[model samples]
Target: MSENGGGTARRRRRGSATVAARTGVAPNSGDILWEIFLRLPPQPSSLPRVSLVCKRWRRLAADPEFLIRFRAHHRKAPLLGLFKEYGGWVSFTPVLGAPDRIPRRRFSMRIDYGGGAETHPFHGTLLGCRHGRVLAVDPRRREVLVCDPITGDQRRVALPPEFGTCGGAHGAVLCADGDEGHVHGGCHSSPFKVVLVQISFGPGHPPPFARVYSSETGVWSDPILAAEGSRGYVDLSRPSTLIGNSLYWWLHGSYLCNMEILEFDVGRQSLAVINSLPVGDTVKSKGCIQIIQPEDGRVGFAMLSYPSLEMWDLKDDCGGGVAAWVPRKTMNLDLVPNMRVTEASIVGYAEDDDAILIKFNNNIFIVQLESMQSRKLYDCFVRHQYHPFASFYSSGSAKRKA
Candidate 1:
């Protein structure tokens, strides 16, 4: 007690010294508080920019906990309306209550490509979306883009040089793991794998060929050549849709006039010809292949037969000797003006949610399956909008489960 107080005092000093020696410094109240803040879930709105603040903050912002919280809050968030004016796309978060209510804020950004005042020569449509990316192609430009709306990240890929001289119009099919299939369905459990199929017209004197691209491998590989014997007169103007790993197109060949479904095996990097829809009398009257996701976690390809919607289960292959075409459900919308089922393209499906989005004559409509009711969402056409496409981002957490 004379030199250094009591034995207890000496032990306390030694304990503090050991902690300082191990950690390189005495723990301060401020340091402990900062650590606690780092472990807490971040605010959703500021997450993207917050990740760029500092290394420590970036890690915290990217934490799975933060994403979960962000997505949970985003689910109830109001829908965002985006439109093009003066040659650029602008986004506005709509007011929840009234359609006439003014938006609280506006986001202005320019898309690099647009049709402008001229009508787009390409007639292809958007097929699928994954990892916040949208895939679109224009036959006129003979170009393809994998784009991210939120980050404005785009990768432009040109068609093969031979595709230019092929004379036949061009079409593209974008495929990715489904939101539910990736999030809930235990399919292939790899997060980095993505399969995209680009079907381009082969040079004159031969059949059309498909180029398959795997995100796992940056290079595109040639798959087995498709039989052009039946696709000589096929129109390339209309885009193809990807259901699962397969791309379907309406082939109007001289030999057989029908919709051709080309299945590209993502794992094998091979191609196989699936069954084709029966040919109808007229070109315009023929049924076009459209992919729709039913709420029950199944992908359905609906072939529009005038007044009726002919649906098929994409997951099941009608046995080799069996008839594949089985009538599932039909909706008669002949009474709706300009709403003929054949003219509208199925843009999105939330089957479990009992809703589907269709694009017809450049207008977007939301329809309820049970009630068979339709409502126009918005008029996306502005200044001859070329190949207008829309895709939503599933939280990265969702892809991780895939």
Candidate 2:
């Protein structure tokens, strides 16, 4: 019986070799090849080049289930570049090098900032990006454009009439799918929601409100007022930080006013105001403040005071009804080579990457929060809004149907 079993195993091995030579693929190698391809870097060009290897490889690479597995294997999307709006034109600055660096022209969009006589003079604002889509407001057209930087697909959704004359506006784009297990890096085809928060500074205008637009419904919902008509100034210059189902924006304050946080709950479709950070007098002078989500995925606050960065986390109370900010670790960035931290401000935050884009002394630098490593991206003296664009993009993946 042992001799018979040994002969049978040898015959099976020989059979596999014969099949491999005939079809150019080893028996059961497809499963192994699938696993190997799943480990490829989540870059836009990764799968396309893999598809070029051969027809079988191309078939496997284009498999929708394989694409989903590839995205799930690498949970977080690669930070391909940063988007900034300047002179009514939104441009993309690639953060990666060579093969991973997406060209600027591929994602660039020219805002029709009411150049024609019939259109209003209101300029478009590049609000923020999430799940591979960019949200921008074109008030002149009374509509918001949802742009897919990967495929260059743009969907124009008209805003509610009340938001037509808003003093200032800041918006957030997110995938509408509420599945917790759903991977977001490649959500090009997923339904999404656009939350537009209106800012009013003058009298007689309607109080600040938020209106949500759902792609599933193809229309905007009724305006949701902030809790008890909470009158707080939203810092439109800074992008919002999304923690859990809530989106947070830093509220700027005047000399007599204290800064606060604006919270928008996507699930409840409600807006509320959170109290100001208990930064205390340690920060005698306010530098650049940004709302950041820390490594634990909790709501966090970061205040950059020239050389040092102070981090804070929101801790829930015993009953969980109220939350308070707790001081976290502070890192000194003065060790950044060759540049004096004379003028420093955080331009953008890459939530998944755990990094922030800092504008220091007319040079843009990307500083990793955990590693504390820094690298200067470029130099720019002009003022612009930067939104970090991170997504799992593939040129061929978009063209192929799932």
Candidate 3:
């Protein structure tokens, strides 16, 4: 009887060990790796933290398959942060992705003129990011730097004659149109072809003529005259916006409330006047064109109407010309006396994505476009302290820390 009981006890212990091994409680190397890959999605933002949990997780996170999956998931996530300030600039990143969630991973970097007692005049901010590399210009020193935010690797390029200016300059990352002929073969359109455009304003000039830069050829081209007979009267407050290869700027004419849209053909290196928005008496008097991209992916330009916010949509024009001003929606401050839209500007359009971020009264507000629910992201100064800009990049690399 004693021998039988001992044998039974040994059998029960063996069964318990078998169950633990099968369920991964005492996981093997393969089980640990598979588990890490399975936990990658939904919590991609937490990858950086996961890697630090254990040695097995760190190795699994660095796996090629894990990185590919992480990149695919991160591309669709929303990220909002300040990039630069003191140069009157701000940017937004509509889509951000990372493959390796290692320490010191940066999606973007900002270049600004460091303010000091000497107060050196600096050009506007410039961002160069594509194919895992970025370039930025320092206006105070008149230099361009090539940097890898992930590796902390950087190379500085001296500015050519055209890039140097005391007043300031603007820079852009331009991508060439891959579907020039609409070739839709097995060839997936390569989104990597890109160029850079920088415009420098001469010192003490009201309106600055823009200097062009091309990353394809890596040289500074000739100066682009803002418009015929209106060289020094254009509005340099807002940075140029790129739709495809073309760059758009809002040029306010010298005449009272006159405005024209300047479209720069980045590929052809030419410029043309596209269309003009109708400036109402109230908007004309305010001396500003407030363009906002809503969460619905619609681009609306608004101007102060005192009590009412007047907005117009440019998407429905059908290229016939600038569409006639139409009122889509209005926010009335009179109804909510305590709530005010301050430092109000449309950062970008998420388009049916439920959430939209807007800057009001120097504060950043993330509001649901459908539900109208809202939350304050941070303090005004903390939100806009860095010059904010927006860009979208492909996802396929390892996850990296932001």
Clashing pairs in 2: none
Clashing pairs in 1: 124-239, 294-351, 295-351, 295-352
Task: Estimate, for each residue in 328-356, the C-alpha lDDT of model 3 and write its tens digit.
Answer: 67653232246664445443223223344
**Collision count for each candidate, in order:** 4, 0, 28
lDDT of 1 by residue, 1-402 (tens): 565667787788767755643343433444453344434332223444555678876775565443333333333222333222222222332312343322323122223465353321223333333333445443456655554444444465675665562245333434344453133111123223333333443245544455655454656666456554333334433334444454445444444444565555554556555555543442243223454543332245555443555555543546775545444676764425755343555544432234455556566665666677877766644222222223222233222210
lDDT per model vs. reference: 0.43, 0.74, 0.44
Candidate 1 whole-model C-alpha lDDT, 0 to 1: 0.43
**Candidate 2 weakest ten by summed lDDT:** 113-122
Using all chains and alpha carbons, the TM-scores for the candidates as numbered come to 0.52, 0.82, 0.56
In terms of lDDT, which candidate is stronger, 2 or 3?
Answer: 2
Off by over 4 Å in 1: 1-64, 68-131, 137-143, 165-205, 227-229, 232-238, 253-257, 275-289, 293-300, 303-308, 314-323, 334-363, 368-373, 379-402
